[model samples]
Target: MAKSNILARTGNEAMAEAMRQVNPDVVAAYPITPATEIVQIFASFVADGLVDTEFVPVESEHSAMSACIGAASAGGRVMTGTSSQGLALMAEMLYIAAGLRLPIVLSDVNRALSSPINIHCDHSDTMMVRDSGWIQIFSENAQEAYDNMVQAVKIAEAVKLPVVVTTDGFIISHGMERIEILDDAEVKKFIGDYKPEHYLLNFEKPITVGALDLTDYYFEHKRQEIEAMKASTPVIIAVGSEFGKKTGRSYGLFEKYKMEDAEAVMIAMGSTAGTAKVKIDELRAKGLKAGLLKPRVFRPFPKEEIADALKGAKAVAVMDRSDSMNAQEGPLCLEVKAALYDKAANKPVLNYVYGLGGREIKPEDIGTVFDDLFEASKGKEKPGVSYLGVRE
Candidate 1:
């Protein structure tokens, strides 16, 4: 029941310390910017016996995830970290781990997907793997990053599904902030030892893993994974509540700020939502009704909650950090619309795209955005998506 204080650290370091406190049996990874430090810190802990963890020095990201799949199949409490192309390299293995119901806990420091080779923050890296059957949760800060890493393990282990704790690349990964870290004993007790129902290394069981599935059972195997993902929603909220009781920090699938009696709202994800929240506060202080609905759980999208949150508003602005490249709508916006479809008299939705390739988004800009949308709601203007702080 003791709380510990640590000096301000980049979110990556806090995540590493949290992983160690959770005490995974195996920690295997190769260095990649933003996320490499997480594994390095744990590797040191393993080397110094600070943690009873096995260190696997894999040559590439592909092998990093492969190592996780192997350890997880054997029922070892396993963890790993990666970013951008590293995640893409481990892309194929992601589904493999999930398909086997490995219950692996991974952290993806969100980065821009490559082609022109962007190394900054965005959702493309993690978004690309959204359909890989992993329960994904996006964190807004270092504390949430640390907390979610621990909770991710609990969620994954509970549902027998793989889970990912994601945060913006440079936003949290590189920025330093003082964080209250949970004690190791509590982590051990909270996460508990991962007890697999079917461990591959169990000689008594001798169960087959990753076996070739014919059409007869292929759908069944995949269906179970999907079912596991759906089951994770309740588990995610439960674990988050436990952490809140322990640390006094509460988070939800979708969190709204200043939405009450507001005529307009901005729904977004990642760190920008926090920025928007602050601006919303300032606007509300000036007597403007502006609210923000920040989606913490990106996968298995929180449809019912979102619809209810934006129900009475005249307008809702959905901000996405990454574009669909050429899609009709940004990923989050399109999903929000679908989440609201079939509802009666919903608000007009505006889809805005920003922060691609690490474009800076300031809070004052959000205020201007609200002014624009508020006017549009009055029939004196029009609502449409525009890049905030993007060069023409």
Candidate 2:
């Protein structure tokens, strides 16, 4: 493995460093709270000649994505960053970017969607675009955020699909932590050059993009996208393996912590997994067979693998940072329930919604969850859909 430099930086700054190393052809972005710093830092890199990237400052997030789509289609490597409302604003272009099979890397700072207008860490933004056909990877901390951003370029280009690398808004994005960064030469070699098979700039071969296909061809095109999304699983694993070899940091679809012989388990994603790990350790010392499963990739869902992991547990709880507003459970819970639905093991699955609008999730809150899971395991009581760390 190559020697890495350790630096103390926020998740947003780490992602910007990865961007500078990748040094794409174009970066089109608008400022949004939490996520604004990522592109802002990258823009400075462009200005200082640290990176040879064309930074396009657009008026709106929609325009930012639109410009990215245009640049990407023209055979340029493209990237951008945005948060909650900004992501919602770019929803339309998100589909377009994926439909066009443009390999644009997006850094999404996960924040709660607003009705009351607040800024903080949550999964509402990324969850809203779950089915937009983009490959999504959630980071547990600043290091993972940086690593994922670098790997996203390879994954996106390989699959001819856009990739969303998400970090918790204020939690990971604004919080500084010590992270190991790959050398610039190593990153450049790892990402390689973005050479498209077909691009608008290739005048030698004329091709049209985003042509209107009403019914006859639209379905087939979408099917191709589905296949590509499915095919991304192996590609993700391959890229992760290569990255691990270089950096000695291995990544999988999901990480299982102390799940072996565990009777009770909790599933979650992003930075909350860090807290959950701490809680799991505390519970383990108390002789409680508690464990945690953190899903790194959310888009492909990893149904079979997740089902296999939870099959042995007597009771399971899924933590969702965003409320689905479905009158029942959140998005992560729904996916977990669906994944385990066919499993013959009669594990009782529970849902807990927490950390919305920058709400703090303490270790005691997580301990309470394990207590409830232990109770549910003993068949004493059933903990159904519940809220964690919320004022009732």
Which candidate wins on TM-score?
Answer: 2
Lowest summed lDDT window (length 10), candidate 1: 376-385
Identify the runs in model 1 with alpha carbons over 4 angstroms from their true place: 1-6, 380-383
Quote the lDDT for 262 in model 1: 80
lDDT score at residue 117, model 2, on the 0-100 scale: 92
Question: In model 2, how large is the Cα lDDT of residue 262?
Answer: 88
Q: What is the C-alpha RMSD of each candidate to the true structure, in Å?
A: 1.5, 0.8
Residues 153-226 of candidate 1 have per-residue lDDT tens digits of 88888998888899889899989998888778888888887778888889998888888899899998888878
In candidate 2, what are the lDDT values of residues 245-300, reduced to their tens digit?
99999888989999998888999999999999999998899888999999999998
Residue 115's C-alpha lDDT in candidate 1?
Answer: 82
Against the true structure, candidate 1 reaches a TM-score of: 0.96
